[model samples]
Target: MKILIVGTGGVGGYFGGRLAQAGHEVTFIARGKHREAIEKHGLDVKSINGNFSVTNISVTDKISDVPRPDLIIVSVKAWQVKDIAQQLKPVIGKETMVLPLQNGVLASDELKEFLPQQNVLSGLCRIISKIDGPGKINHLAVDPTIVFGECDNSKTDRVYALEKVFNDSGFKGRVAKDIQSDIWKKFISICVSAWLAVTRSTYGEVREQPETRKVMRDLFEEVTELAYKKGVNIEPDFVDKTMAFIDTFPPESTSSLTRDVWEGKPSELEYQNGSVVKLADEIGLDVPINRFIYYSLILMEEKAKKK
Candidate 1:
């Protein structure tokens, strides 16, 4: 399969490297020193399962330079999806599939606003990985998995074909029965954990402390309530399930949002917590905790953008 990976950061670098290693035609859209390094010396992936390198692959900074691909995996931050979707217009063939593996639930929706609805697929990925260096990717934890499906949850041959591609590349893949609920499941857990971690507390600290833990629960409930109001059929006991999921995290674990905020870089505060607040306000729902989180970090977010 011919694949184009946009935003070759942690998620894109690792998965694209795997696909390239499997002998699929994979091209990466990257920028700055990362693009230069990948061009000079192939992309390297250091993983717990195994290590591999994707040498002699195409790497470009412009989407216009690449050929039309069978699939385009968008792995950029949530806030960048709209711009990337607009930039992808020239390459989206009639049968081309665009899958978004961003951190939040709004990526596919954002893509649909700019691209054809039939060409967009809702997707989410589970992996703890990052760009270790300019040309290298590090798979730090979790068995990498991708869950995706059609927008309306209908079974399609194209969806299964993509699943085959993922299975052949040596990672876990599943076609979601309910892609929206699956996306929300991930959103609820990540949204709560990320903001809590931003309070300068590790997973251990957040879960162990009574006050912080209570805040975490409130955040989860607020998000889940928003999901219900939006008509997503999430599990009733999802809050308890999310707590159980957090319990499995390593004590010192922190989210990508936490890391970005700590480094004073532009983060996904808008798409995560800010999205919840925006959606809730549209429906006249009061998401006080989420509103608080968004307002608290928005100034810092604006400052990072200035930098």
Candidate 2:
């Protein structure tokens, strides 16, 4: 399949590099030294499974330069997904599919608002990797996996084709029966974890204080409640399962949002805690814990944006 990887950061670069290694025609959309480095040397991925290089990578900041692709994998920050969705219009073909792997539940909706609903697929990526250099990506922990399906949850031919694509490329690719619910599951986890990271500092620190942990649990509960209210049927005990999952994270581990806040880099707060607050309001519910996180992250995001 001809693939265009927008925002070639760690997650994009790692998976894109693997696809290229598997000998699929791949193009990368990136900027500055990253794009230059990929065009000149190659996109490099260092992984525990294997290391490979895409020296002949097709890369350009301008989408018009590349051919219309069959699949477009959007790996940009959650806040940037809408803009990227708008930019995709020119390059989208009649049968093209846009899969957004942003770490939030609203990405498909954002894409649908710009592109035709048929062009946007319900999807999310499960990968712990990031760019280490201009054209280098480091795969840190999790085995890269992509979960995607039709928005309506139908087992269509296209969804089956995508599953085969990932399977052929030798990585995890799942076609979810309830893609919306699956997306919500991922969203709730991010909401809780990002809240903890933004407020308490680290996963370990969030676990250290009983009061902070309680707030973290409450955050999960609120998000889960919001999900159910909106018709996303997550498991009844999802909150407890998520809390147990959070406890398994290494103590020193901090969420990427927390790292961004600490380093004063741009973050996805607007779609995370902020989205929770917005959704809560839309649903006519109260999510005080998420509201607090949303406001706090907004302040940090503002300073980061200014710098």
The clash count for each model shown is 0, 1
**lDDT by residue for model 2 (106-210), tens:** 888889998988888989877667778899998866568999999889899999988988978868899998999989998898876566556657787887789
Clash-forming residue pairs, model 2: 10-130
| Candidate 1 weakest ten by summed lDDT | 192-201
Tens-place lDDT per residue, model 1, 1-307, is 8899998988999999989999999999999999999999999999877988889999999998776899999999988998999999988899999999988888999999999999999999998788888999988777899999999999999999999999899888899999999999899888874565458777778999988898999999999999999999998999999998788777877777877887888998888998889999999999888888888888888999999
RMSD (Cα, Å) of candidate 1? 1.4
Residue 211 accuracy (lDDT) in model 2: 89
* lDDT, residue 8, model 1: 94
Model 2 misplaced regions, further than 4 Å: none
